[model samples]
Target: MSSDDTHVGLHPDDLDLLERLGRIAAVVDPVPDEVLELGRAAFELHRADALLMSLVADAGAAVRDNGAATASHLVVFELGETSVEVEVARRGEFVRVIGVVMAADQPYAGECRVSLETSASTTTQTLDDGRFAFERVPVGLARLVLDREGDQPMRTPWFDAR
Candidate 1:
């Protein structure tokens, strides 16, 4: 076929039809508010040169015989020579998170920011020993973001913090 015979652009009718379909879909199956909020949060967390930490281990939250008074879990993430170990424990109606960062190649010498992000709140701690903690955090889906000077930020995958 000749180049002139090929049509690459969509007709005005096609565009209108797509718009109508989108409107109908939205009305029929609307996105949940939580989903939209999560989407926006995820978008905002994006970093072009950030290092995405990989989950290496997760020890499920253990329930104490005394009930929710003392439940705890551990999760670990690593990327190259850097590893982050997080331990989340139940504290009253909320939770407490303690973590330590270990980087063999590049030590976290100076103050580093460690952020614990949940659906409800975002808490940050800055320390030099690669140690950090967050207290009275609401229980929900959570992720960790580690930022060190002169280094790429590291983010952990979202995990349920029940």
Candidate 2:
């Protein structure tokens, strides 16, 4: 069968098999886009390739859900060898960033600089418990860059506010 045929839909049995396979594969692979596409192709073939078809169907569904789950308004970041947790949230026209820095080792007193590329505003402070929060930022592709004197500045992963 041609790819066009499989794109149409899958047989009931094939769909069931795909769901089961997708569930199992999700445990290991988590996202199975490739598997799903293969299953979709097999479905188009419209041949009685039950075993192969089932595996592919399951993988496809698993990947779909995984993608949806990661789409979030808030993004969190953890740096290596650093005792800090940064949380960024998009609210209407403003983006809020909350930073929690901890003194895991020595006297934890250091300045943190928070910069937002969108607004071109920078906030600096001496960390208390290494924590700081920024509010009233303009929303839209904004980059939150954090920096300390000795340590390198860290950038939060890009995320859409709206």
TM-score, each model? 0.66, 0.40
lDDT of 2 by residue, 46-87 (tens): 323211101011011112243442212334444454444445
What value does the lDDT take at residue 152 in candidate 1?
81
Per-model C-alpha RMSD: 15.3, 19.5
Model 2 pairs whose backbones collide: 6-44, 18-58, 22-58, 101-130
Clash totals, every prediction? 0, 4
- Candidate 1 lDDT score at position 22: 80
In model 1, residue pairs whose N, Cα or C atoms come closer than 3 Å (at least 3 residues apart or on different chains), thus clashing, are none
lDDT of 1 at 78: 93
Model 2 stretches astray by more than 4 angstroms: 1-73, 102-109, 119-126
TM-score of candidate 1 on Cα atoms, chains taken together:
0.66
Which candidate number would show the highest lDDT if scored against the true structure?
Answer: 1
